[model samples]
Target: MSPVRRGEKLPIYNRIGVLRAERKMTRAELAETVGINVQSVGALERGDNYPSLDLAFRICAVFDLPVEAVFSRTEFGAMSAELYRRPDLRPEPQSDPGGAR
Candidate 1:
């Protein structure tokens, strides 16, 4: 697989690395579980290649996570940032104290 060009948008982004780290799973271990080469796992994690639908399903099964949680077309921002984001707590713009034209 070709390396993704810098600044090029990938068709899909994955949480494989995060998931592996969370589960303390090595690439070889995950590869064995998914019946793929270890290098393929690394490539998938690095966004060098997109997974086939079958492979995607296999990966999700290995992680026990929904496809949406494992992969997304849009970039998934940092989990901590997303979890801590406070939209409602954002300060509203101060209204004009006096009604000026």
Candidate 2:
């Protein structure tokens, strides 16, 4: 894995496994619905891989949730699309002088 950039991280989901589990749905079911492999579902559940845009929409369709309802961004990284929330609007100062400060 590469070093975490200022705005990037291995985005952990807010609710994929949790939601599916709540609905008594299996990984295979989600995979089929999203047109991905069950292993991919397992990977997503473990934060091992990120989903494609089409897959994201598919997941949302299955859950009847708005994109925002499923994704939430955090101070460090973005949340899964299925659980994404609004990003912070507060501004932060940038560093200079070779990031000495």
As a TM-score, model 1 comes out at 0.73
What would the per-residue lDDT of candidate 1 be over residues 26-75, giving only the tens digit for each residue? 99999999999999999999999999999999999998989998999999
Residue 38 of model 1, lDDT score: 97
Specify the highest-lDDT model's number: 1
Regions of candidate 2 where Cα sits further than 4 Å from its true position: 1-12, 75-101
1-101: candidate 2 lDDT, tens digit per residue? 65777776656464687779779999999888888889988887677786777877788899999766554453223335425766878889776869674
Give TM-scores for every candidate, taking all chains together and pairing residue i with residue i.
0.73, 0.60
Candidate lDDT values, in order = 0.92, 0.73
User: Candidate 1: worst 10 consecutive residues by lDDT?
Assistant: 1-10
Q: Which model scores highest in TM-score?
A: 1
